[model samples]
Target: MLLALYAALGVVALPRLLSQVAWFERAPRLAIAMWQAACASVVVSALLAALAVAVPASVLGHGLADFFEACATLLSHGVPFTSASARIALLLAGVLVVRITYCAACVLLSARRERRRHAEMLAIVGRHDSRLGAMVVDYDECMAYCLPGRHGLPVITTGALRTLTSAQTAAVLAHEHAHLRGRHHLVLAAVRTLVRAFSGAPLFARASSEIARLVELLADDVAARGHPRVHIAAALVGLATGRVPDFALGAGGETALVRVRRLLDPVEPLRQRERLVGILTIGVLLAGPAAVAAMPGVRAFLAHYCESFIF
Candidate 1:
């Protein structure tokens, strides 16, 4: 019986398990880590339950009646619902729900609220031009940030505007344009969701930050691809790692280190690893659920009872 449960869990959780390890060992970024951890939590919890139960399958044959009989007999010893295994699952699910809820609140409060805040602040610093883009200077000791919405947020500071050459200004504009064009802020919000979703899991925070950095890299590429380096360089120096107001556009923020490094020396490549290792990790993770699913009795239980447990 224990074997049957473990096997079933392994099958059901296999895909998620493999994905967790694959993402963790590979990019080790935030979104990937969150997913890996969340999935890993459920699968690992099940594995531990299986270990505790130590059930012995009473019947094994091609016959359906035998499968049902054995399952019934083994479970009658101690139904899984009241077992320690079920308790682990219950705890994990509760924690995950809280984590996801907190994450959503953070994003809604952080990036989403910033949009409204900017709308009010913009009237004082910059005017809206549907075609030319909006500009502002925010002195709030925050790093310069540009987020996209119905209209583009293009922030230029009194200091930055005063310091940079027109060429630099254009370069800065190009960089922010990249952010607005690519919807980088929304991507960051999504990454944040991934980050908080797996708050208790290892490497999840690093992965989320990496994803943010990657988006910045992507934006930098768009801004600098066809322009003179000096302009963007000047812009980065002007932005210089301060917190631009939440309501304004700035050339840099969380990704400042990577951007500076790339600007200084541009040959860095994305990390690559042995595909086989990633594949195996993915295989192990994926096996978690599929293994569970493959057991007919477990599947029946899930379909009839446990499905309700899934949020």
Candidate 2:
């Protein structure tokens, strides 16, 4: 029951709390990890809460021998739940698992189909540029993005080519390359799955949108490592009006103005101690639920196995 309450509180509170923190803008990568961890924590706590009701604490205390015997009996005889609460708890856990799995499959399949269609379109209308290492489309809209996958590649429009100077173009391409190289699409896909699975859940919805924005900031940081920040900012400004397909990760989007400004006027990043604290927080968010769920089983195992041992 406590675990369920924790999950509920996290769903309602984490988004609001995390969003209010200013340090996230200075360290987008760390912020992304924190958001992901928070989501994972809620899911794990909810699942474990249901399982706790279905499985008796006494069975866990008896250690692995008894636990395995119970499992074997369950498998061999298909023993029915002894209580209505146990039956309902197991049903709840199973439904949550199946829903998430189904949603994940849907998100991945839809993204794959969209990418395939977009790839085919690109092959027809775009030509590869060896010097720039990107697919050049002859459209009159300043745009740049990457198609991420096995044959992932950066893409640019002729309009952007004419608009941006050589150095600025390099910066923009670098940003797209960072997205491809980092496999950031998979990260987006995972968050999208959560949002789809939970539909109107505020935590998943907010996390998905915020992570998408943070991803852009992260890519800009990567691009800045290889190119001048000013060049990247200038390229973003030039490509601000352009749009890319939903399947593609683009260099410019609604966040372009904010990203451009961030690039031009950099803020001080988290200090070493602050970063360490953030890392610890992420660890706790990820592991806290599992530790809570395992405490009874662990204590049981220790008692059964170490009863005869001397300290």
Candidate 3:
């Protein structure tokens, strides 16, 4: 039952609620953390629920010793699943593991391929820019973005160099630098992997889009530390129509217009108390499902020890 609730929340409730939350737009880092916690909680809760169903209460009642024995039985001849529910749970667990692993591999491999291709392109057509501390690609498009890897390089186009003022260019570079510094691409890649693996799942799709947007907002925040918000907004406008490689984090994209508006009309930063509350909320969202999932084992442990003491 707990597992079902978690699955429902992950697949339906949380995604819908989060999509509608305007506060998340104001506090993007907190929002990112919440999304991550929510995703992890759902996965963990689902696995625990599967285990709970597969291993009978009789086995769990005997505590850790019997738990390991049951695991060994499962590995050897497989446990005699007396109930259809047990068989279904075991099957679900297997499917989850395989799905997650395959999706992760796909994401990694695809990223590597993209990076390799981009690197080759950069080697041929890209020039080093000491002033900007980035690679200058001699393209006509007004673009600025960063390709992330061991040899991660920020790239700006000749067109962008002509289009943006010195301050605007600085702001754009700062934004891309933040992306590279924070390793934001990995966060995006992970969510995207889940989406690819579960193409039918609206939750993963929503998560992918939301996380991507939040990371952009986060990068904007970082850039704002070093450059005027107005300059950054201007840079966003200058680069709004520019194109970057699919794998790269660009200064302008679908969120650019909204980001520009945000920069121009910035909201006050969250108060310390509000930040604390947000942190606590993330903690509860992550821990609640886990605690609920562990209850059966905890209860069984207490019951077994109490029975022993009584005897």
Best by lDDT: 2
Candidate 1 lDDT, tens digit per residue, 23-64?
332232333434444344443545444433433222221345
Could you arrange the candidates by lDDT from highest to lowest?
Answer: 2, 3, 1
Question: What local lDDT does model 3 show for residue 79?
Answer: 53
- Once fitted onto the true fold, the runs of candidate 3 whose alpha carbons sit more than 4 angstroms away are 61-66, 77-79, 241-254
**Cα shift from native, residue 15, model 2 (Å):** 0.4
Put down candidate 2 lDDT per residue, 1-311, tens digits, no spaces: 88899999999999998889788989999999999999999999999999888988768778668878996898699999789999999999999999999999999999999998999999999999999999999988777889988888999999899888999999999999999998999999999999999987889999998999999999999999999999999888777644343456554455877887799998788899989989999999989998888787788777766875755
lDDT of 3 by residue, 28-127 (tens): 8899988887777777778878878887665776867888987887779965778999899989989998999898998989898999999998988899
**Cα-based RMSD of the predictions, in order?**
9.9, 3.4, 3.4
Candidate ordering by TM-score (highest first): 2, 3, 1
Best by TM-score: 2
Better of 2 and 3 by lDDT: 2
Tell me the TM-score of each prediction against the true structure: 0.55, 0.92, 0.90
